[model samples]
Target: MEELLEKLLQAVEFGKVDFKSPYPPQLKGENGAYELTIKALESGVGPQQILENALVPAMDRVGKKFSENKIFVPQMLMSAKAMGASMLQLKPFFTSGEIKTKGTFIIGTVKGDLHDIGKNLVAMMVEGAGWTVIDLGVDVPSARYIEAVNNNPGAIVALSALLTTTMVNMGEIVSDIKANLPTTKVFIGGAPVNNDYCQKIGADFYAPDPQGVVEHLSKLAS
Candidate 1:
């Protein structure tokens, strides 16, 4: 079981989706996250063990490498894809209540932003960390975010914007969310977003990269 979990971890970390995926040349033809995860389950490894031992640690390392500038968007995306493949095998366990999630996360790109790469990365990373993710997609308005919060009570909200003009919308959205649901915590990010801007907009947190969001969620969950 340890060997299988180790292989699964390496597969997800190196972006190997399956035996057929050849993106990471050195891992070509090896059983990737998809197959390895299935195998682990079939061999009677618990779902939570796979998530905590393999998926979380793999994404954590990937996130740290990304934060350190050792890995760029392409590599990060590929690692996310690999992690996603493993998650698919574990979904049934999640739905069956055998594997529990940390909490819920609601994320989106603010209105007029129309950028989703950063939002998507954060969503994937948070989901990989064992949280239920509700992605609102790009160009999300305050109403959409509020509605999602209403639907998923106690969910942490995350907003992303790539443009300065669109990022201004974050302040209004944050204000609206606070007014509507004062207990809700809001997180913001993007190229133009900074710590000071986050405070100015009344958001709870601001992360320059997706990894920061994952780390914040971990601290909250812990």
Candidate 2:
């Protein structure tokens, strides 16, 4: 069982989605995350073990590689795809209360920012880390964020903006959330956002990459 978990983790970390996937030549024809996950469960491996021992560790590795410049967006995307393949098998477990998530995360690109790739990447990475992600999509207004938070009380919110011009909206949204909820933690990120801007806006956190957000949330969960 331990060895099977290790193989599943390797498949996820190396971006092997299924047996048909050919990106990693060496893994060709072997059962990938998609197959291995189901097999593990069939073998009586606990869903929580699959999450903690395989998926979580694999995502952590991908995140570290991304943060260190050892991997780029394409590589990270592949890892995320592989993680999703495994997640599909685990979803039923989550729904049935066999696997419990750490918390809920609501994410969006602030109003006026039509960008979504950055936000999507963060959402994927966070979800892979065992948190339930509520994606509000692009061009989300402050009120929408507030409403989502109201619906999922105690949920963490992450705001994304790719353009400097549109990034100004983050400040307003952050202020609104703090004023209304007061206790909700708001994390901000994007190509144009910096730690200084995050501080100025009174946001709780600023992560340059998806992995940084994952790490921050992991700490919070711990």
How do the residues 1-222 of candidate 2 rate in per-residue lDDT, one tens digit apiece? 999999999999989999999967878989999999999999999999999999989988988888888988787788888989999999898899988989999999999999999899899889878899999999999999999999999999999999989999999999999999999999999999999999999999999888889989989999
Score candidate 1 by TM-score against the native.
Answer: 0.94
Per-residue lDDT of candidate 1, residues 1-222 (tens digit): 999999999998889998899889999879999999999999999999999999889988888888898988788778888988999999999899999889999999999988898888889889878789999999999999999999999999999999989989999999999999999999999999899999998999999877889989999999
**What lDDT would each prediction earn against the true structure?**
0.92, 0.92
Q: What's model 2's lDDT at 202?
A: 98
Cα deviation of 32 in candidate 2 (Å)? 0.9
> Best candidate, lDDT-wise?
2
